[model samples]
Target: MIKPKHNYTGKPTAYLDHNILNYFLRHPETSAFEKIFEEQQVVYSDETLREIKRSKGKENDFLNKLKKLNAMHFKIFVDENHQSTNDAIISDADPFEQYARLCEQLHIIDKIYTATNNTLRKFHGDKSLPSIEELDQQQSSDFIMILEELMQKKSNTDTLTSEQLTKLNNYISRTLQHQKTIQELSTKMMLNYQRDDNASMINTYRAKVGIGPLELNNVKGPKIIEKIWSLHKDLDGYKGRNFSIEDFLGINYIPSNLNGCIPTSSKIISAYNVLNVIGYFNDSDLKLNRRFTSATSDANHVALASFADTLYSSDIGMIKKGRAIYEFLDVRTKIITINVIDNRPL
Candidate 1:
C-alpha cells in the first residue's frame, strides 16, 4: 500500500509484463517498483492473464497484486457499425474475477469439444476434415451464436461467473477447437522453417530482398529495415510476404476504430517476429521458445503493450524487439527494461 506524494488527475498509463511485476513483488529492490508504480496508472490485459496462467501456483498472488494495485483491465473491440469503442480500457475490473471467468470458459470449451468431436465422429466416421469456417457457415455447435455473444461483451452486464459471459467462449472454442484448422486438428504440425543446407535463413532472406549473400556477421540495423521497405527491393518484406515494412512503418496514429486497430496490432506483431527471425536482437529467454505458440503470445504482448504510455519488461529480447517495432511504427510508448538489482528478499 504505497501512495504517491503528488496529486494526479491524469497519471500516465503503464502496461507491465510478468517479469517486471514479479520483480516488484519479490525483488529486494521492491520499494523501487512501488515508487514507480504509484506514479503511473498500471493496467492489465488478457495477455497479462495469459502469461500469469503459466505461473501455476503463483496465479492467485499476481491476480491479487494486480487487484490491490488497481490495475485496469484493457481490451479493444469493434462495435456494431465496425467502429471501436473508446472505453476499451476499463478501470473497475477485478483480475481475480476475470481469471476465474477465463478459466471457466476454457473448461467449458474443453467439455463442449468432447461432445462436438463425438458428434463429428458419428456423422463423418472420425475421418472427416473439418474447417471452422464451414461450421460457422452452417451455424453448427452454436458458432454463430457464440460469435454474436463474443461481440456483445461490451454491453454484457451479467456477473462473469454466470452462464452468459464465460460459456460464450466455450461454445466458440468447442465449436472450432480453439479455432484450429485441419493443420492443427488432424496432424502434429511441424515447424520445418529452417531452409536447405545451401540456403541459410539469413542468406535466403538477403537474396529475396535483392542483397548479395554474406556471412551471418553482416546485414543489420535500421538500414536493413529500410531496405526491406524499399519498393524497388524484391524481398521488401519478410520472405516476400506480399507486403513490406512500408505497409505499416511510419504509421504514428493509434487507431480509434477496430478496422484500423486489428491491422495495426497485426503489423506490430509481424514486425516483432521479423526481428526475431532475422536475429537482429536475440538477447533474452523469450527467443528460446520460438515455436508458433509461445512466439505468437510474446509478439502479441508487444502489440498490445504499444497502446500504453509506457511498457515495462525485464525480457531483454522483448524489450529490444518491441523498441524496434514501436520506433518503426512510430508508436510513442516508452520502453523500460529492468533487471534485478537485489535478488535477496525485502
Candidate 2:
C-alpha cells in the first residue's frame, strides 16, 4: 500500500471507531484493513469496549483483532494514582466525567419516578403494579434498592398518612415532568451537522484551498432556544429555564485543553455550532433515535481521536462531522473514512 506524503512527528496513530472493529471481524482476511492496521498505531476507547460488549457472541473475536493491532484503549475515568491498568490508561479529569455524573443523577431520578408511580398505582388497588418486595428483588443499583427499601418500610407500616401520600404524589409528578425535560435535552445533545444549508459557501472556500467542499444541509429556528436552554440548564449549571441565543453564545463551557489535544475542544464546539447554525436543535419534533445514541458516541469518539494522528470510521455521519470540525478548527488529525483506507491499492 502506498503511504500518504504527510510528515509525522512520531508514529502515525489511527483511532478506530467501533464499527470498523466489527467490520474487520466480519472480514478478518481482508488484506486492505490488515495492512492499514499493520502500518498505523491504532487506538480505541472505553466506548469501543462498551460497543464490543454489545456485540453478543463476537466479543472475543473483536478483542483478538484489537489485540493483534496492539490497540490502545482509553478509559472514561482514571484512578486517583494515575496508574495505567490492563484495560486503559489514566486520564485527567474532564467534561466526560461531569456528563457521567449528570447521567447517574438522571438515572436515579428515573428510578425514583418508576418506584413511586408503581407504589401509587398499588395504593389505588391496581393489581398490576409490583409490590415493594418485588421491586427490591428486581432493583440492581444501590440507589434503586434504597428507594425500594423505603417503599417496603412504608408498606410494612401500612400507615401511609394522607400528608405523606400527598408528598409522594407531588414528588412523582415533579420527577415525571423532569424526565420529559431530560429526554428532550438528551435528544438535542444527539443532533449533529448532518445537514447544512451553507454547503456552497463552505465548498467555495474549500475549493480555493484545493480541498473538496463539505456537503451540509441547512437547518434554522426559534426552537433552537429550547435546545440551548436545555444544554445550559443541564451542562452549564444555569438555573434559569429560559435562555436566548446570546446567552448560549456567551457561555464559555468548552474546556481549553482536552488532555493535551488542544484542538479537540474547539472541534467539539465546532460540531455543535455546525448543527446549531443549521437550526438542528430548534426542531422540537426531531429526536434522537433510541436504537442508538450516535451523536453522543460520535462526539466522544472525536474527543478520543484527538490523541491520535488519524481517525478511521465507517460512519459517514462521523466522517462528515469530523472532517468539518477538523477543517474548521485547523486540527492536524487526519479524519479518513474506513472505505477510503479499504479501497487503497495493495
Candidate 3:
C-alpha cells in the first residue's frame, strides 16, 4: 500500500481531467474553470496526455491547449526498485513540454495502454491471459502454416521426412496446449465478469440478507453504505462489524499504505472499478458491462490526482467516484464538480 508523496507547497493544487480540459479547449474564452486556475496550483497528468493522443491528428493541437490553463504535470513515482515501470514524471513538471517530450521520446501511449488494460484485469482477478497479444497472433499464424504443411504431407507419404514429422508433431502439441490455455483463460474471464454483475450480486445479497438493490447516486450516504457493508459482511466474508471506508478501497490484506505494500495508484484504479461493480458512484447503467471497465481514463485520473490538493472535473461520474475513492483511501484531495460549482464562480 503506497500513497504518493508530493513536494506540494504554496497554493492548493487542482488536477484537471481530460473532459474539463477539453471543455476549456473548446471554449477558450469561457471563464467556467477560471477560478480553479486562478487560485489552485492547477496540474495535469499523463492521463490527460493519453486522451489527447487519442485525438489522433489533433494530438498536437490539444497538447498545445494545456498551456492555456497554466497547469503543471503531476505524476506519481513508483518505488526506486521498479524504475523500469517507465511511468515516472518530473516532480515540478511543465505540463505542455513534459507531455510533448514524452510523445517524442517514446511510444508510451501504447505501452501504458497495454499495461493499464492488464492491470485492470488483475484488479478484477479476470483471468484474461496476460495480454501476450503479439505472441498469440504469431503463434496462431505459425500453427496455421504448420497445419497446411501437415495436410500437404498427408497427400504424399514420399514427401514427408522423418525430421519434418517430428518437428510438426511438436508444433502441433504446443499449439494445442496454447489453445487450451487461451480457452481456460477466456472461461475464467467470463466467470469473473458474471460474478461482478451488479444485479446478480445484489440479488445474491438480497437472498441471504433480504437487502435489495442499492441507491446508485447517494452511494456515500448511510443508506448505500449500510447496504454495501451488509452485502460484504453477509456474503463476501468481510469480518469487520463496523464499516471501514479504507477497506472499501485499500487492499484489505495490507495493514496500511504507510507500510508500502501496494502502490496507491494501482489500488485507486482497481478500487474505482470495484466501487462501480458494487454500485457506488456507478459509472455504468447496469445494462451492459457489470463493471465500468471502460472508464479506464477516469481511473487513471483518480490515481494521478491522488496527491493533489484538489481535482476539478466536469464529469459527474468522475466527481462521484473520485470523491468516494479518495475518502476510502484517505487521500486529502478535494473534488470540485463543474455542475456543483454554481454559475462558474470565480
TM-score of each: 0.59, 0.46, 0.61
Q: For residues 13-66, could you state the per-residue lDDT of candidate 2 as single tens digits?
A: 788888777777666566677677676767666656556555778766776777
Per-candidate clashes come to: 2, 10, 2
lDDT of 1 by residue, 14-79 (tens): 888877777656753447676678888898887788778867788988888888788887765434
**How far off is residue 330 in model 3, in Å?**
1.8
**What C-alpha lDDT do the candidate models reach, one value each?**
0.56, 0.48, 0.57
lDDT (tens digit, per residue) of candidate 3 on 1-346: 1335654566777777777766765666667567547877677776677677666677766766666656677566643222112233435555567766777734534443443344334333344433334434544555455556544655468765676565556545654564445434434433333443333433343344443335455435434434465556644334544536455543452322223466666668767766655556556543232242347778888888877777877777777777766665567778877653433433
- Cα lDDT of candidate 1 equals 0.56
Full-model lDDT, candidate 3: 0.57
Where does candidate 3 have its weakest 10-residue lDDT segment?
79-88
Question: How well does candidate 3 match the true structure, expressed as C-alpha RMSD?
Answer: 12.1
* Predicted candidate 2, C-alpha RMSD: 15.9
Ranking by lDDT: 3, 1, 2
In model 3, state the lDDT of residue 114: 44
